[model samples]
Target chain A: MSAALPPFPKPQEALDAPELLQVGSGAEVDEPCLRADAARNRARLLDAAGRLAAEHGAAALTMEGVAAAASVGKGTVFRRFGDRTGLLAALLDHSERKFQAAILSGPPPLGPGAPPVERLRAFGCALLRRSIDELDLLLAGEPSAERRHTFPPRRFLRSHVALLLREAVPDADTELLSHTLMAYLDAALLHHLTEQCGLPPERVRAGWLDLVARVTRTDPPA
Target chain B: MSAALPPFPKPQEALDAPELLQVGSGAEVDEPCLRADAARNRARLLDAAGRLAAEHGAAALTMEGVAAAASVGKGTVFRRFGDRTGLLAALLDHSERKFQAAILSGPPPLGPGAPPVERLRAFGCALLRRSIDELDLLLAGEPSAERRHTFPPRRFLRSHVALLLREAVPDADTELLSHTLMAYLDAALLHHLTEQCGLPPERVRAGWLDLVARVTRTDPPA
Candidate 1:
């Protein structure tokens, strides 16, 4: 259906792209007030929160729970994060950096040691899994339509897909094809397919693999 | 960066779908109080508004202008549609129905006489043209996230595309592939590529044909 207004919410700042998600070491620059020990404490709390979210769900994570998990005062969590939104944002940034590092340098397939097609398959599957785990958290941070593509993390992921597609399908229009491929892995679309449409995560995963093959014009992996 | 949100605005009812767009008769059902001549007059006014919109972009549409163009009293325009929102919605529905009719029954390629691939190509080009014309109106009518895929008109178009895809690539999962194909023509994405990214409509149109070819694993048409 045609919308009366453009469907995307206009986003102001893009989500972090390449550099902003540089894992733990980079965040300290944004918080000059944190002395070394406090920074360590903050990292510890965040790590504990990550574990809590993984064990329960991102939706179940609470500042108090994180403190308890870290064996610190709830005040410590509050003093560090300010609010739930802040905590969740930081957690996402942490997770993004971790994920980025894993793909950028961690190992084969998702990293550098595999073929482009295999890498593309691994990337979508990995992204799908990460999205499913953090669906609620990711959904909340959605930007407006204008900024959706420019958002840093999304740009990074799409660029990665484009890179693989370039190698895999040298003759294809990988730029737009990248967007087509990334559209399948979009957080909102994935949420729609899995939660609203009642499609299973495995089915969604299979679909992504199928999509990669079609876009790359290759046979689907057996 | 990974979003804290899953990110789509969860829309409930899809923006008006197929039936909501029945040119004029269906709207009468919503207003049983109007007399025959009054209904005819109202439709006439809408027709004038549609002409005005096409001539001067939907963004330029105004009640005063619509009245002047329709050669009716400004009061009549206000009375008929109540507000700009109502009028635009009516206009969108009116336009949607006209478009639906053409594709469902009009002529070869776009209608039914040509092969499915040709029809598919015509369908995208025609949609791209319609979108370019009503970009603002359609965007304004964007549905909430939950209702987006389920939105009736979009579903109608996607089902149409899926039908073609099934014939074009019977082995593919046309259901998901249809979504993939539709994503290429998504209003938001089009707005981004054309307006934000500054890609011309022809470029986008080209991309769609290429995408269709790649998905069907066929060479681009001559």
Candidate 2:
């Protein structure tokens, strides 16, 4: 807890953090400013890096492995990402874009075509899956405790929950309710329950459904 | 994070940690071995320390201040608790015991006589008040995230909430539900909301009531 740099910067100041689907804002990325072929190369490297992370955990992702996976030179990997920290940040931003896109417009439950309660359930499950798949990546990427709630990705996720909660429970305090709901899905708690306490994915998912029902005043799905 | 010690130790390892009220089993503590006058003296010192924590916050609760407040020598204060860390640990244990005692037997809503849901609401409000009052002390004493869920003081508090949740929502998953409820009153979260976000204490207290109602599927108090 010294001057050690956090893997990611504050959301508003995270110049490189992908702008996660800010409603009404189109294409909020830093616009890499690469030529078409170079941009395609960058995407390829990130995609390969992501696969390595998902398959072997983020801790296993190395610049050389990324270069080998993408069939690029190790120097190219270093030049592209600066170091392991840079690669991880880009990896999170890469996955966050996909996640943001899915929640914004990709499908039914998590996107626009489902009930608020259903959306809430889908959102948590999706996040849980991602957290599990990218456990080390996320735990490493986590901001300091003081900045955790205000981090951009976190803000985006919390707002999404609040929106659905407001729709699902107009009579309740949805803002606070959203915080309560999001707390269940926190990275630290998830790590404790799943990895430390050895709860399987199904139990965690079931808990999420039960929680959504309790907060939304709905029956759990049959 | 390095091996550099946090201001506090793990609860179980905290040699001087006050024994919390263990349900069904009764009081579990390292009983102070003292004669009547010595025990009274120890209590007086602890009481003075608690007053200092409550009045000026725990950061200001120095051995010198406690000695002056309790009309004892500084050497007596240090000898009684070993050092600053020892004194703080003892102070927290002292507070934890009082808090546990209140919930177990003190009176209506916060204690055993009232309904579980009522007790749950009162528990959060009371905890939020104490967390706000002892924000610095609790924040410094927070266990590392990995051990947070299993920390003895935290486990004691969570179990108490779980017991109430069992009675209030027998149909639900009380274990996970207790975690949800506890998360809302977490010392770090409370500090962020009150000290960082500037939410008034009344708002936080109201939010707690709303959360209890939502999780319990009851109407908020009008």
Candidate 3:
């Protein structure tokens, strides 16, 4: 069975920022006088979380370890992040924000304003590259325990890709086609490419570009 | 980590003959020919096994239940199928052979003989159909713990698609591209369509056809 989406009570909170922390916290934290030391502590905690996730698995990450690494008290870490899963969710949000930026505005190919088809190819290629780069982070975000009914980044990514496909193909079922494309671009496929098939990154990107071009081209099926 | 494939082994004698029984003098008697009673017993055993598997799932199937359902001794069930795993394997084999035929020689589009693109489209449609019709059987055969190094059916299926792609896009790295396409058709994707996304079977098929046709059309990258 497919894993259920994460069940955040207010799903919109996860979808939109400025309200992200409000799902559980009830109100937005709009305090303007945040101390410099508080921001430093927050940065240190997030940094420690990333290092731990990269060095060990997400499952291995512990609040105690994070607190020790950040040189913060255990109570402060818990007060800031709640629990392990909560911390993991925050980590996912942090990574997704960075990934979203790359896709939306980072540079040529992956960024906006390029031809729809080329940009789509770049998106797939860049996603594969990022998957390879942040495997542990991606793996950690996987839905387990069947608790929530939230949208996955992959879902949003697929939807965005589908929007691009509408421009490329213009005639196909955009949503379903997007799902099909995302299915292929899954972490499993990326893992198989680099880990199982031993294909190099440039070669994988080239192959992806060819597939996108072939599929999105105006030529009728032979 | 990916599931390990099982090593292939020779078929056991118990599954080879369904109607044979040991006589008092250790002679193997063709029970279906000599004892009408023995033939009925064999049929009963198979029916019971099927029911149990359908009811409790393939994993939950037990020889003990088969014996009770068939009104046969525990030893007789073991004598017929060797063990629960063997029985499950045999059941899976029966269905797999039929599926292989459908893809390999059963019809146009899906079978060998159609134009490569049509064949590829048919292949995906057939696979997605099978994923819905035989989810359990498909799940059982994968990540099999035999022929461990062999690519999955999806991989092989994609390889076949890649061959077609090579014909259309000779310079592209179609091999890896095929892997990506196969992943798109994975059971998980099918589950998402039918179970999670709540789309009908035809919708998924149409999407696949459109995807394959569009992706493989002979167009240069934009």
The best-first sequence of candidates by TM-score reads 1, 2, 3
lDDT of 1 by residue, B74-98 (tens): 9998887888877887887777777
DockQ of 3: 0.18
What is the per-residue lDDT of model 2 for residues A161-211, given as tens digits with 9 covering 90 to 100? 877886898766566677788899887888887787666767778888888
Candidate 1 error regions (>4 Å): A1-34, A47-75, B1-36, B44-75
Off by over 4 Å in 3: A1-40, A55-65, A73-86, A101-112, A144-151, A218-222, B1-90, B101-114, B136-160, B163-169, B218-222
For residues A1-222, could you state the per-residue lDDT of candidate 3 as single tens digits? 111222222332233222222222111133245587876776678789988987886778899999998888999889777787767776766666677777767886787888787788778877877677666565556542121112455555766787788778776566666665665566655655556556566666655665665566632112
How much is B71 displaced in model 2, in angstroms? 6.3
Highest lDDT against the true fold, candidate: 2
lDDT of 2 by residue, B86-121 (tens): 788887777787888898789969988999988998
- The CAPRI-style docking tier of model 1 reads incorrect
DockQ of 2: 0.21
Error of 2 at A205 (Å): 1.3
lDDT of 1 by residue, A1-222 (tens): 111212222241122123434333233446567788988888898889888887887778898899889999999889878888888888887788778988889798888889999999889989999988888778777766656776777777877887788789876656678889988887778787788766667767777887887788787887
Task: For model 1 chain A, give the 10-residue run with minimal summed lDDT.
Answer: A1-10
Ordered by lDDT, highest first, the candidates read 2, 1, 3
